[model samples]
Structures are given as C-alpha cells and as structure tokens.
Target: MTTVTARPRAGRDPMRLPVPRRVRLGLLVVHIVATAAWIGLDVALAVLVFVPMLDASWTAVCHQVLPLLFWPLLTTALLSLVSGTALGLVTRWGLVRHWWVAVKLVMNLLLVTLIVVLLGPGLADAGRHGRALAAGLPDVGEVPRLFMPPSVSITLLVLATVLSVWKPRGRVRKT
Candidate 1:
C-alpha cells in the first residue's frame, strides 16, 4: 500500500497554497482595479465637497453630482474588500499572518463602515443643506461633517496602499 502524507507536498510552502496561476493573477488584477476605483471615487467626492466652498454658485451642481457618487463608492469599496480578502487567502499572504495585510483588512472594514454609517447620510444632508444655502437660507452646519471624513478615508486608503506595496515586516506567529 502507498503511504499518504498529511502535510503539503515537499516543494510547496505550507502557507501558500497551490492556487491556479490564472486565478491568482485574476484576483490580483481585480483587487488592484477595485482599489484604484475606490480611491478615485473618494477623491472625486472630495472635490465635489470642495466645490461649494470654492464657488457658492456651484452649490446646486455639487448637490446634483454628490448623489451620483454614492453607488460607485459603495460598489468599489465592496469589491476591494472581497478581492483583497480572496488574494490574501489564496496567496502566501494569509489575511492575519502579516501585519500589513491585517491592518489593511481592518482599515478597509472601517472604511466600509464609515461609508455606510457616516458618509452616505452626511452627503445626503449636505446636499439638502446645500440646496437651502443656495436658496439664501442659513448654512446647514455642513463644513465640519461632510468635508473631513472623505479626506480621512482617502488618507487611510493611501496608507493601506503604501503598506501593501512595502509589505513591512511583522508577522503574527501562529499558536
């Protein structure tokens, strides 16, 4: 009778499973594209928020543009998270194995949460108040709430991208 080994074959690394090459490449491409899309969308939203400050005349147009961003941001955020998770799982970079991946995962999750809980509603409120402001009503206490979060999100995303590229040392040892 032939003996069977419980562990992975001698040539393969234990943490890095043998995923098909094409699948790995596809996942990486999707992850990268999604990340770019997410960052782009956030930056666009930031610009839109700034428009009203730059020109009071543009308030109505900004209000119109802001609502359109909601869906793209939501979609790209979800795709980045899912594709990144899959990449981590299928590659040598197990999700929590490396500090960078773990941090990115947490950051992305927080970003998603912020998008859902804070940013979306803030945008809607800002749009409503913007319309009112354009109509010559008092300001809507809008400066602090809407302007800051998108910048913070963009910063976090850029940080995550740096961590991904740098892949700094600090691996979580398995117990």
Candidate 2:
C-alpha cells in the first residue's frame, strides 16, 4: 500500500488562497462607503435629537422622523459589517489575524447588536410617543433618551475608522 500526498501548485502557497485584487478593492470601497453612510445617519440623528431643545413642538416631528431613518441605518450598518468581514477574510488579515482587525470586528459586532436590540425598539417607541404628542394626548412622561445611541455609535464608528486608518497594532500572536 502506498500513501500519496497532493502538493500545492508551483509558486503558490496552499494555505494562502489568492483573492482577486479587483474583488478586494470592491469590498474595501463598499466597506468605506457604508461606514461613511452610517456615520452620516448618526450625525443626522444627533441633530434631530437637539431639535426638541430648540422647539418643543418639533420634538414630536423629530421623533417621527427618526423611525424613518431606522431602515437606512440598519442597512448601512449591516453592509459595513459584511463588507469589512469579507475584506478581512479575503485579504491578508484573517478577521482575528491582526489586533486592529480583531478590534474592528468586535466594535462592528457590538454596534450592530446595539442597533438591533436597543436602537430599533427605541426608535419605535419614539415614533409612538411622537404620535401621541401630535394627537394632543397628555405626555406619557416616558421621554426616550435619544441622544445616547447615536452619540455612542458615532464614537465607536470613528474609533473604528481610526483603527482602520492607523492599523496601529501588529498581528495577534498565535497561542
């Protein structure tokens, strides 16, 4: 009996599959654009959060407008996450291969989780409250704190962007 082993092709490493440069570039572009969109959405939300302070009646209007942004915000966040993960997997960085990439992956995951679990429901509640306010009903006194979500999201996103740009840390040492 003979045992045979197949070897990698000439000049190619079996462990490192080559991803097309164009495909990687496209993924990078998508990741960047999606991240920028998410940041923009957060900025818009922050601006809306301040509206109530300026005009009390605009509070209902701002809250009503907030729900409309939910879908777009979610879409952008998911796009950024998916594209970033794809880029990391396809490129030299294998998701957790590098410290910066790993940190980014964690931040992205956390942001997405918060968006789904907290932000979505908060937006819905704000919309409902807005509707009630517009209906002339007495204030239910449950003013949803809208500032924190966007503020926190923006901060994390900017930090992620910085990590991406700086790529400060080296690869994670294998145990």
Candidate 3:
C-alpha cells in the first residue's frame, strides 16, 4: 500500500502557520490605535515644550507634567512595536520581506530604544528641575532640550505612517 501527502502551494512555506482573518484585523486595529496614541503623546509633549518657550513662568509646570507622560508614552510605544511586529509576521507583508515593512520595523525599534535610554531619564531630570524651580532653589541648571525628542519622534512616526499608507517599496530581494 502507498500513501500520498499534500504539499504546500508554490512560494508558500509549509512551516508558516496561517493566521485567521479576524485575528489579523484585531492586530491591525491595535497597531493603528497604539501608533495614534504615540503620536498624540508626542504632540502633547511638543505643546508643553513650546509653552515653556512662550512663557517662562510655565516652565516649571510643563516640566513637572512632562515626566508624568513618560510611562504612558512608553506604554503606547511598546504596544505599537509589538502589534506592528505581530502584524508583519502574520500578514502577507512579513516582518522583513517587504521594504516598507522592514523600514518601519527598524524605525519602531530605534524609537523604542531612544524612549527607554534617553527620553525616560531626560523626563525624570526635567521633573527634578521643575521641583527645584518650584521650590525657589538656586542652581537648578538649565532644562534639557525637550523639543528634540518629540520633534524627532513625531517626524519618524509620521514617516512610518506614510509608508504604511503608501507601501511605496516593493519586496526586498532574497539574498
């Protein structure tokens, strides 16, 4: 007796598990919401940073409130990263298969790393300075360049969003 087994279709890997349509949709929603939230946080931060420039008296208040956004910003960022990664893995675009997806992934990773390594500590220091300023203490030093972080993050995020909508590049060539 002989037995026959079905083979995967051409260009499809047998080991690659298929994701359900509903699950993919869910992931897409999560990714969109998280990305939007991250952008919103950056916008708020940008406003706060700008306020200090317009009115020096608001500096202490802005700095004090800026630190509070750290956790939420980090949370949204992480969510965006994870959802985007999962979407890439399960969807046809793949994590690194398509050029646009690959670029977005790299951007997300870089943003997340910057948030953890630079933004987090910077916000904490700002909070401390704000407290010192509020207490009328001398030698609080100058506030760090708060504009850079949000400005850079927003730019990269908007670029990523544009890439998602345009999907400009074709698939990366297999080496």
Candidate 4:
C-alpha cells in the first residue's frame, strides 16, 4: 500500500511555465491597431485636417494640432518598440539568433530615432513657420522647409513591417 502526500500541489500550473498565447496576441493586436491608427492620423494630419485648418484661415490651429500629434505618435512608437522587443525576446523569432533580426532591429532603431527626433521637430518648425507665412506674420526665414524626415521614417517603418512579415532571410536561410 502507498501513502498519500500531504502537499496539495505545486505553487503554479505547469502550463504557465510557457509563454501565454494571449499575451502574444495582445501585443500583436495592440501593435497593429496602434500602427494603423498612427498611419491614419499621419495622413489625416497631413492632408485632411491640417489642410482644412489652413484653408479656414486658422494657421495657428495647424500648429496646435500638428504638435498635438507628437504625443500620440511618441506613445505609439514607444508601445511598438516595447512590444516588439518583448515579442523578440519571448518568441525568439530568430531575432537574437540571426542576422536579419539584428538588421531589422537596427532599421527599427533608425526609424524610431528619425521620427522621435527629426520628423516631429521638422514638422513642428515647418508648421509654425509655414503657418506664419500663410498668415501675415513675420517670416522666420526666407527659405521654404519640407518635412522629409517623416516621409523617410514612414518608408522605413513600412520596410521594417514588410521585412517582419515576409521574414526574408538573407544569410541565415542559405546556411
């Protein structure tokens, strides 16, 4: 005859030892939703919203709205960065083990840096100066400025997303 043990059970479920699917799904959903929203806002801010403000003789409004986008943009960017990092670490989708992931990480870093540092500042300055030009206010400078960084940052973002989706293996695959 066998004697029963006094211990009820282990402290935690064995399944919990593995990463939860819901956590991964939540991260993906949040990243996708935020990304889509950010793109929509970018287009809206650039074409629909800001242009209308300019049309309505509210140049100052453009400046206000333009700067306002920076906060959400920064937040989404930060979320994307954090979630992407977590996903990379947890899933190990060849991120740490392979070169492509490293490349992608570098690309993402450049993209985020450009947006966080370059694009927003350029847009803000241009918006303010452009608005002033639109109005009768004194010119900050005679030269016209363009927000090229945003365009470049968006391009990098799309490229990185495509790379992540397609997972085009460069040297790692052939080996």
Task: Encode model 3's per-residue lDDT on 88-125: one tens digit a residue.
Answer: 88877888888999999999999999999999998998
TM-score of each: 0.87, 0.90, 0.92, 0.68
Looking at model 2, the pairs that clash are none
* Model 1 residue 84 CA deviation in Å: 0.3
Candidate 4 per-residue lDDT, tens place, 1-175, comes to 9998764356543222247889878877886776666666566456523463447555555554566677777777777777766667656464455566677677767766866766677667757765676677875763223345445556667776777788775544544
Query: In every candidate, how many clashes are there?
Result: 0, 0, 0, 0
Clashing pairs in 1: none
Candidates' C-alpha lDDT: 0.85, 0.89, 0.91, 0.62
Off by over 4 Å in 1: 1-5, 15-17, 131-144
Evaluated with TM-score, which candidate comes out highest?
3
After superposing candidate 2, which stretches have Cα over 4 Å from the reference?
1-17
Error of 1 at 15 (Å): 4.4
lDDT (Cα) of model 4:
0.62
Candidate 2's displacement at residue 54, Å, is 3.4
Model 4 earns a TM-score of 0.68
Candidates arranged by TM-score, highest first: 3, 2, 1, 4
C-alpha lDDT (0 to 100) for residue 65 of candidate 4: 55
